[model samples]
Target: MEFSGNPALYRRIAIAVTLYINGGAFIIFALIKYLLHGDTWVLGWKPVLVTLLFSLWFGRAMYRWMMRLDAQYGRGSGWVLESVRVKLPELRPRQPR
Candidate 1:
């Protein structure tokens, strides 16, 4: 399948995948912590805060890295963009008010 060559669509897919990865990791970590220590706050709020920060950082980093790779190598199969194309609404730049 031919892609529309839309960077916006690529970006959206990258972001969505990154979020799912980070979210799943966070949930697993929370579950493990709760099971082992009987509470998610076993280490207090600092660890939770750190986990949240790390997840966000990791997700953003992954998205940027993937986007860079796609830009450099081009989409080989175009499967990723094709699968996500219909899910994402058309994006347009907003005019200044």
Candidate 2:
């Protein structure tokens, strides 16, 4: 659950969070629009396309920001990068006959 130092993990988490947040925001906006305009925009392609574009732009921005912060503070601190070592199978090099 803790992705503190791993840039890959952090990026993935950031993307997921951004998607959820943007989706929720769009849903709320749609609800408000529905209440005000009575579904007029809901059936329109323009609104849907605009919302999709906005969400993609916002998500990309958020992802970049999160990665920058992780690199600057999280990984730089040497704490988030702390990880446990796991034992793995040992391999021996083959000798030339």
Candidate 3:
């Protein structure tokens, strides 16, 4: 889950997993249809295209949502691209005399 620390990696994995599950399920439907009958429109290029498009839209929304989450719980009250540039430093504990 720490891999999600990197926004790019997190987004990529999220999108990949989403599309993979949807795509795999669609493929299974197509295969089952083919096995049961001969051919069907349930599985084809259109489904894949539509899924990809939906995945893109989902990714965009997720990105925005994650940004907002980071803003709310991470730094300040709002989300800004500039936030990425500023790194928060960890404070070290002083020795107790």
Candidate 2 C-alpha lDDT tens digits along 1-97: 3447666776677678877887777778888888887876664888778777887787777766776665655444454555799999899999999
State TM-scores per candidate: 0.49, 0.54, 0.52
Off by over 4 Å in 1: 1-4, 42-44, 72-97
Candidate 1, residue 34: lDDT: 85
Give me the displacement of residue 51 in model 3, in angstroms: 2.1
Q: What is the C-alpha lDDT of each candidate?
A: 0.67, 0.72, 0.68
Residue lDDT tens for model 1, 50-93 = 76787778766765666656564546435354344456778999
The alpha-carbon deviation from the true structure for residue 61 of candidate 2, after best TM-score superposition, in angstroms, is 1.6
| Model 3, CA-based lDDT | 0.68
lDDT of 2 at 7: 64
Q: Per the 3 Å backbone cut-off, how many clashing residue pairs does candidate 2 have?
A: 0
Which lDDT tens digits does candidate 3 get at residues 1-97? 2324467765776677767866777778888888888776756788768877877787777765665555534454555565356679999999999
In terms of lDDT, model 1 sits at: 0.67
Model 2 lDDT at residue 2: 41
RMSD of 2: 12.0
